[model samples]
Target: MDAGSMKAESRCPLQEQFLQRKNSKENLDRFIPNRSAMDFDYAHYMVTEGRKDKENNQAMSVCSPSKEAYRKQLAEVFNMNRTRILAFKNKPPTPVELIPEMHSSSASASSSVQQAKLNKPRRHIPQSSERTLDAPDLVDDYYLNLLDWGSSNVLAIALGSTVYLWDASDGTTSELVTVDDENGPVTSVNWAPDGRHIAIGLNNCQVQLWDSTANRQLRTLRGGHRSRVGSLAWNNHILTTGGMDGLIINNDVRVRDHIVETYRGHHQEVCGLKWSASGQQLASGGNDNLLHIWDRSMASSNSVTQWLHRLEEHTSAVKAIAWCPFQSNLLATGGGGGDRCIKFWNTHTGACLNSVDTGSQVCALLWNKNERELLSSHGFTQNQLTLWKYPSMVKMAELSGHTSRVLFMAQSPDGCTVASAAADETLRFWNVFGAPQVISKSAPKPNREPFAQLNRIR
Candidate 1:
């Protein structure tokens, strides 16, 4: 017969069975009688066979399938087809204990997979955009004062009696000193550059130096003053603190124990304090509206107790002062008065160079180490930041953001960013290449009655 005639005449039910089987395991001999099983991806078929091949460690590859195999097994299994046996249908699943290591592909049909999504841990965020904010933030722990970047190892006196030491390298904090009920909210804290020790100023005219490396409070000088501790500053080896008692005390940290020296000068509460960049002198400001520069080198005998120079132009209490790290003779002082303004003066000559005016009371002053620009914050007023050129005191730009009050400001060591703290306790950062922007606002009192009421009703 011709090929066309043969094609029309040939017909077999085998082709129908081959077309329907999911695994297509109808035995190739029933279709292409001469084909070998090697034509298939045997590794794939063996894995999908849903059968165990125990004899051949590797699954069937057109080879042996001899685990308890042969005519006897065939005769015994002949009575029951796959559907009648039913053991494979309701087989107990792979134990939950063994599922962790299994990485089943998504194409797999078995919904019985018990794999845990541990490698891709899910974050606890209700909103898709909610991020798991880390505590050891890149900049959150960087503490700063008028003197320097309080950005390294730091300590803070909080809740009156709680002395908290924080490693600024990362936000790892611990309550190191708890001074009973007599303690008031800590007004000042300082960490020596070496990070070996920390000094905390408490409300009760006391300066306590604690060895952070030793993890113990080393000593406390009670004879320094009889008033509430208000401000403290320290460098690598010295501690200088001024308090409501109007006394300035310098503690030598070089000694194993704290050695305290009292400088009698400011007649009113000393509200601001800073050490000279070279550590040769100490400057303290008082409610007397005076900035007194003390010759710290005069720690010797009967030297008359008085300021080397007194700056009395400021009519109100000076709140902050920044000593230039590059030049000890140049300094800037800020105060709160009827009209908000800051006074920049020469420490050596007591000459007022410029008086900078702000829309509100100035809370903090930050000087750029590399440049001569000064950044200041106005207490809770719009457009509170005044960035000005030094000496000339010309306004460079005004930064606006804090809706409540800008209480503190610090320029990063590199001057790439500036951090401003507000009465809102919200630390906002600004990029100066273009202009400063307000990112967020956090109230200092997070759990206050207003917030409490909102949460309770919610």
Candidate 2:
């Protein structure tokens, strides 16, 4: 090769190396402090030594190619490290601190969803009545279950000493049987499940079975109670009667010696008696402010331990007792003047599930078979009937009409109608338990005025 060409190529490599070293020194000074000062000292040494070597040897290079190459490599590495440090210092912020915030947001969202489910709106139900009839001379006793509507659409009511049968379909009333005044007045009345036989409980402590269709007394079962018989309930051929003597008797109507089983739990008058729809459980409430739950298996045993659960939460008389048609384990009972509370119990576990203050004396409680609703009849201040939505216990409607307190209530076989007997000497049929109806724009509403008025007997 020619000398000029070789010299130019070697000078080019040295110039490029020097340029790279100069740029790296500038970057180091801008990015790092103490390291930049060291790089400046090394650069000064290279420049001064190169000038001296050039003067001493004209044909040779100012510095050894190997040392120059090494310096260049060090400069390249420093530039790369400087670039990395600058990138790290200028990088964007991370979201590491937001992890807890994300969790809290999710937790709040789940709580909101659960609350929305609990507060969901319920269906709006209308309150109205279908018909009303006068229950003349109807006893006003709170402890007596004087009214019962049979499955055959016949209503049997005990007014004083007379037992009357009124055919709901034909509106014809007939006297079933009249008890002797010596038997004290008929305190309670209940019909058999088959709607063929009716049980009459007397103030004389006697329970009698009668064939209502034939208008004949079948037989009188004695040794029921020491005082007045106040309540009666029937499960098939077995009739249960509660009395003022605080005694409960179960009579099997199919046999002659009808007194099959006896239960003694209350210290005061046994005023309420009800059998579950399945006839597996019997719930009785008494004036002693106590509630007793009895299982059918207890009927076979003559032992005093037949009492399943003796609940004493009520401070006053517990004359209101009912078995839930939907839940067999559930039983509801209400207290009188002093307590004024309705408590629901799980009979299987003997746990009180819920309780509600009625604001007045709760005289009677009835469950609607068609809907998840409960009807509670009240006495004292308002003397009103309240329809409540079950489980939630929201008051759907308050019915007012009876001038006196409604002490007794009954449900019809269809499950859409309810008959409430009040001290006003009137029997009112309410459609409050019926399913809500939808009225179209073209159809006109019926006259609701009759429902509010008293329909006295002709």
Candidate 3:
């Protein structure tokens, strides 16, 4: 079978070996320049000469033609005139009015009038308090919110086991209610929007709604929290209460089943609660060094409601919460003794916009309803009230009279006065914020010259 076939097989191996070596040599030769074919020295000389020519051209460009002429030359050389004509690198300014007419006299007059309004004199604030009253037995606990001013111009404050109300209009003081030994001390008190109904939080985990006009209890709400209710805020018909059990409950006062929604997040007592002016959001601060934002639209009675934001930026307990009167999204919260800082937050985005170190404990915060200013009550070494300009945070004035820590502060209905109750047991009212501006609608009639009336006689 054969010598011929065996010889053919032997020849096949030699042919394949030759092809393999040839392919390898071809690949290796691809990267190597052709030394014999290409003029290496000439190529190098051309590159060097071209580089020198470019440098010389760049040097001569010091006295070159204008940019427009150069662009025209480029367009001509490349036949790009059509493309250049269609492109607009800089557009002309837009006309304010369609028809060309001069408005100089009227425009200048209106602008001058606006400038005069802008230059109005600044209001004056008194350095000393205008009045002072005795707040005997006012609770000194930092975690308890025991003072609030109602829209009715009535201020309610809790003292030990009894709650008292003072009418700011007539300067009358009256007792609101007193809890028994079991539910001894009142933890918090807030007035509803109607100003006639008040919500009283008790140490025995009870919330009472009372009618100030009739001076009678409306009802008692239970099954909301397991510990003492320390903070209370009202939104329309709904009453929000935060308790020592780290729970926030929304009670709808109109329905018999008052416990409507519950917010569960904080691990410690919630001491601060404030509803925004729009009544769409609620901000709560607790002893766990946490701040939570709850949205009313997301709340449900069937399940535990989720918080819109859980801000853990505070290093200590947060008790002071105030929503800006001018801006709905801006919120201000103050940290307790350990933190000694006031932080501004954008509630919609949950971003901390600014923070200022107060150097002392911030116990309460109140915003002027008529002005863009803020008032803060501090404790410990200073025990003074600070009036600050918002956004700038400049210390406008520092009023000091309390001998002990200023634990509570409330603003008057007109936002002209601030009542501060300190651990010193004295309630001092300051005329810090000036009276609201009164706009005059009446304008003086222009007087006619004597000769101007002679035209009618003629």
Candidate 4:
């Protein structure tokens, strides 16, 4: 053979190597892991791998039917068919705007209109206070709960040594009682469920039960704490009190010997206290940054009662405590300046459900009696009241006006108005939560009544 015949018959060494590598089994075949054997994110894997498969399919004009049948068979054996994997009978319909050619000219206009609808607020929220009243001598202390609104359309507030009641029905303000210089300034005030009865916690470490209807002092209960009493809650006739000495006491006001159960948990001043609507659970927050949920059935007159759940997640003092009116087991709590976050809990399981940073000290939290919305009062930087949508925790509105930190908040009986007291020495009322929707009379009520457990309290 001559040189010309050899050159025409053979190729370059580099070209031969390239051709061999191109048709190699290692380059053509890919390793696909058994997705069912390993617990990987199937959706993510499908999304990413599906994109690669589409690119490869586009690169090559020919597809092997036998190889495709093999993949389908593997998917069926593993019960991982793409459509059946997510258990969807059909794919979701694509939004009209997503498909462009159908309405090419009006596409931009239609999308903008849909965007406007989505961005609109669910309901209108007033940006200003409906009414403002001067709160002279109102205590500026963060740990003291000095304001409460009774269900009788009456609001009781402590100013200096006197306690006053403001009627929401007729817009009348009346003086309830004035303490002597020895017992002087009031620390906390709460109205009983009866609305006619009210409890006043004093600086002298005493809790006085009063009759607002007759304007008379019913009785004085003592020996609950060594320091000033700052928190009080009522579960039927049982009056629960918390003081600066880190003690929680349950007093049965119907009997002469009132101290029935003592909760021994907090090491710092107990500043916040609330009872569940069902009256089975009691939640308390303290200056030590701890929250404890106490079971009423665990109460013992023979021995000190222990807490059911001791939550130590707060980085600062927790003074804001509120029970969900619609959910008996759900509780909401807020931390102070050092920890500006609102946390939710499941009282039954003691699980922290959710937490949201409010960017300021949360002073008090209140749930709308008729709706799932929540209103939170804050301290520092704007001193505003924030209305939030539950579950989502979206800030619907920020009602601002107070010049100082809002220390206390109380809801009215109708759940329409909120009364907030700030260090600015003014009490402002905001109609943030809209009027509740009226249900039809023929509507079926739930078969279970959670609050019916209150019958077993005494």
Candidates sorted by lDDT, best first = 4, 3, 2, 1
Ranking by TM-score: 3, 4, 2, 1
Residue 135 of model 3 has an lDDT of 68
Judged by whole-model lDDT over C-alpha atoms, candidate 2 comes out at: 0.77
**Residue pairs with backbone overlap in model 2:** none
- Per-residue CA lDDT of candidate 3, range 79-112, in tens? 4433121221334333343333447887767666
Candidate 4: tens digits of C-alpha lDDT, residues 1-458: 99856853663211111112243235646555554444347666676686686566455525676766666687689865554223313334444554354466587777777768666566668888877777767889999999999877898889878898888887777888999989969999999886777899999999888878888887799877898999999887788999899999998877667899999999999999999888899999999999999998888999999999999999999999999989889999999999999999999999999999999999999998876789999998879999999989998889998989999999887788899988977788888878756756775533222122332222
Output the worst ten-in-a-row residue range by lDDT, candidate 4.
Answer: 12-21
Q: What is the per-residue lDDT of model 1 for residues 70-181, given as tens digits with 9 covering 90 to 100? A: 6338646753223221121333334444334345674242324434333333222111111111111111111223112333424232323555443434645565767666
Candidate 1 is scored at a TM of 0.57
Candidate 3, residue 374: Cα displacement in angstroms equals: 1.1
- Could you say which candidate leads in TM-score? 3
Per-prediction TM-score, please? 0.57, 0.68, 0.71, 0.71
For each candidate, what is the lDDT? 0.57, 0.77, 0.82, 0.84
CA deviation > 4 Å runs, candidate 2: 1-128, 435-458
For 1-458, candidate 2 gives per-residue lDDT tens digits of 99867754654210111112233226554543344334554455456664575454443334576665665587588662231211213233332332233458787786666667556555444453455666666788888989999878898888778888878788777888888889958999998876757889898888877777677776787876788899898876678888888888887766667777889898889988988888888889998898999988766645543789989889999988888889888888899999999899999989999999989999999898867888999999999889888999998899987789998988877677788889987777787765534545564433222111422211
Best by lDDT: 4
Colliding residue pairs in candidate 3: none
- Model 3 / residue 367 / CA error / Å: 1.2
